[model samples]
Target: MTPSSSSEKSFNDWYEDEHIPLLSGVPGWLDSGRYRLTISTTSHAPSYVALHRWTDLAAFDTAEYKTATNTAWRTTVMEKVVKKERFLLQYKGELCNILDTLL
Candidate 1:
């Protein structure tokens, strides 16, 4: 997601309101993380990374994330502000220990 260098308001809104909530809603969506790059270095500008985990490869493949994101963007209150393109990514692994809990 690229925006004009002068567009601070757009960036804040996109992150806080749109991108975070929309991506968080996908089925089996585990997590999405954001990082502000080079926190103490001379390069003060921020760059973000998103981390996503799914239930499994097959489940992710059928999740229809892009379609759902587009539908929400076009049909909800989110439509008023966000303008970022989503790029889908996938990986394969036999995931283990999805959760641990104690009662």
Candidate 2:
């Protein structure tokens, strides 16, 4: 999430304290985590990424999840500060190669 300095504090506060908690209530939602990139080829790369884990994509269709994401704060941040990109993925489980380098 890219937030202007003025909105940064509120945005981060709301995301961490409110947004995630709300989304976590969805039926298939397992976890939600955020990260900031420490390395990038250019500034245009996303500064932050949010990873939301769910049992399946069907979780997104729930009314609770939809309502939670359609709030005023989300609209404000999306319109004025952050441009979000979403990627739907499947977890392949842990890497278990016995001889793989630990690098």
Candidate 3:
């Protein structure tokens, strides 16, 4: 997600101090991390990315997850996001094992 320049600090603060902590308390939420895009080739790429891991897709349907996402601070911060995207990917087997089988 990319926040407008004026809202960058607020976005960062909300994400770090509030959002992550709240989500971390949810059941089946394994871990999460945030990253900045430093070398994207696309001109309009979002400035930030957040990766979250869960035990299963059911975690997203939980009350805790819903509560964590529906906060006033998240609403305010999200309003300033110019672009955002979300994807849920299932984990395949290890890369090394796959590569060895191919070789």
Q: What TM-score would every model get versus the actual structure?
A: 0.49, 0.78, 0.86
**Candidate numbers sorted by lDDT from highest down:** 3, 2, 1
On TM-score, the candidate that comes out on top is 3
Model 3, span 1-103: residue lDDT tens? 9999999999999999999999999999999999999998897888999999988888889999999999999999999999998888988665467767888
Q: If ranked by TM-score, best first, what sequence of candidates would result?
A: 3, 2, 1
Best by lDDT: 3
Select the stronger candidate by lDDT from 1 and 3: 3
| Tens-place lDDT digits, model 2, residues 1-103 | 6676677777788788779989988899889889877898887766678888888778889998998799888777766575556678887777577777664
Which runs of model 1 end up more than 4 angstroms from their true locations? 39-46, 58-64, 71-103
Query: Candidate 1 — worst ten consecutive residues by lDDT sum?
Result: 73-82
RMSD of each: 6.8, 3.7, 3.2
lDDT of 1 by residue, 8-28 (tens): 455656666876676666677
Q: Which ten residues in a row have the lowest lDDT in candidate 2?
A: 77-86
- Lowest summed lDDT across 10 adjacent residues in model 3 is found at 92-101
Q: At residue 54, what lDDT does model 3 achieve?
A: 89
Q: List the pairs of residues colliding in candidate 1.
A: none
- Per-residue lDDT, model 3, residue 17, is 96
